[model samples]
Target: MNVILRRLGMALLILFLAGPAYAQIDTAAREAYLVDATTGTVLLDKDGERAMPPASMSKIMTVYAVLDRIRQGRLSLEYTLPVSERAWRMGGSKMFVEIGDDIRVEDLLRGVIVQSGNDACVVLAEGLSGSEEAFANELNRLADDIGLRDSAFRNATGWPAEGHVMSARDLAHLAHRLITDFPDHYHYYSELEFTWNDIRQSNRNPLLYRNVGADGLKTGHTEEAGYGLTASAVQNDRRLILVVTGLESQRQRAEEAERLMRWGFREFENFELFEAGAMIEEADVWLGASSTVPLVAQNDVLVTMRHAAREEMTAKVVYDGPIAAPLQAGQQIATLRIEGPGIAGHEVPLVAGVDVPPAGYFQRIYQKARYLLLERQ
Candidate 1:
């Protein structure tokens, strides 16, 4: 049985006993979420987990589904898809694709991403799964594999339909995945405009045109869903993904996206708390040659939090002890959990710094008897 202990070891270093205080932001969006992409720290969450209509913002998933197929060698950027009557009849946004025309895959991606073309989505869906409805089933399967728990996709176009929904957190996660998983295709989100068939349409994402480091993602709008945007940006190699939905207008969407992006980047920063192989403390061992085993980290432990919370955060060493003997060096023996205001929760693994072989047989027996006798006392 593992004994639970909350006591800090002799190596307690950081001062962190005060009450916790996380950062907060005022947002006009009905749903908003901001996170540090590199560290997976959630900086802001306001109705972020609640499922709602994502409007065209759902196109990001459609695009993701296509990109994944490309990665699996089932599709290629050079592949062409035929525009069907269903696609040509699609309403809302338009890629101006003509029926019976075979459009290149690259062009279709641009049409869907840059123009938010419902029709382009249908073409890609039809080409991939023989129909948009079938492709939507494939999308749900792919979404499950990608770990989207609260999203349900009913159409490739993100058109108004029952049971079509996504949480802000899910959307932000999708944005982060696109940036990290598809470096080659991610550049498409940054394109300012695309021209096809004598028509030019600018990308709908407002962040791309601004001075901020924002790059890729999509925007969604419907009378029921309002305006929403899934945006990601990098400042100094640290990326932050922001998802906002239910804004009043296009201008509000632009303003809220920029404001949240600025707030997230400016308020949060990454700090390394411990280096790899650094000794943190010593944990007691049971019936071992040595009474204590040095505890150390196996990797760098870095945390992202508000700048003000660095001094307030407390680090605690938690482990079951006295740890049993016969342990090899580098065996994980404890967790270094951190908590405080403006800080995201983190639990860094602390491993044994040295071998802990069992004590001699007689010594083990003697220790056991002594422990039993002491228990009686």
Candidate 2:
């Protein structure tokens, strides 16, 4: 059989649009990353891998670590952890728990998530792992397991330290995990406000305050790290995760994050390309009971791209043919490659859609003779 690659313009309705995948926009952050949660497509990236101070944004990981323990049945929301002197003495944000007081896991989680309480994070850390230092080890281990390639945690709170750091991509990945992995607990990030010990504070995430379908996320700021945010939102049933750091102020962080979120949802969209078992091609068969075998995918194919770029997409069918018969239905054989402007590229497996048993003895012999005659000519 010889390799054959055929343009699928006739077989496929690939929309060819004008312009790039998405329009480019300027940003103020030193590092940034944006991704669509529904399709897992990265829409924007700027110095995304460069690890920098994440400030309180690292609290997301701390919350993740604590939630992981709860997820494993090692702890529960009803359980309580004692606040240590170290936890009480922590200088940044506070849940205001008295030293030696036992606090509920539920409230402590809120303190870290909605309140950005440094003291609360330390309490959860020491309670879960016996010490904050030891808990940092657990956080790193969990980070490795979760693919946090450019993150290093020296403490539960994202305090300014010489080596403590996280990249925008790492923060965005963490946000995605929180939203997808712990759906039951993710509501904490969306809480408009939380009160503990007669003190209340609103969620610092700017997107949550707006009507742009934003919910759940954390914001951060420190002299060394400037201001930062890691957030997610759903608009028109589409979810997007964004991580940005190194802005100059709180206002800049909110404005920039919201603008990027709106831009991402406006520019990109999810498209259903094909359904499972859809006949993608009718491939010729050699010495078979049937003249051709249908080709199909095992599952549906979907892609995300900018509006103009989707119109410019192209597709093709590729296979080694003429395929020998006795082919069975659903036999994996061919490939479908799809490409377009603003799309990196996508490939779907094409399987044999129908059976084609070998032909009768006389028919087989006739096909073999015909092949030889054609080759000689």
Measured on C-alpha atoms, candidate 2 has an lDDT of: 0.85
CA lDDT of 335 in candidate 1?
A: 85
lDDT by residue for model 2 (289-359), tens: 87678888898776788766634667666677778889988897777777766556667788999888999
lDDT, each prediction: 0.87, 0.85
lDDT string, candidate 1, 1-377, tens digits: 02233332333435443343774889999999999987788999999999999999999999999999899998999999999999999999999999999999999999999999999999999999998889999989988988887899999988999999999999998888878889999999999999988999999999998777988889999999999999999998889999999999999999989999998888778877778898776787889998788888988877787766645677777787878898999888888878777554678889999998899999899888977996798
| Model 1: residues with Cα > 4 Å off, grouped in runs | 1-20, 287-292, 343-345, 353-377
Q: List the candidate 2 regions with Cα displacement exceeding 4 Å.
A: 1-18, 282-294, 317-335, 349-377
For model 1, the local distance difference test gives: 0.87
Show pairs that collide, candidate 1. 21-341, 21-342, 22-342
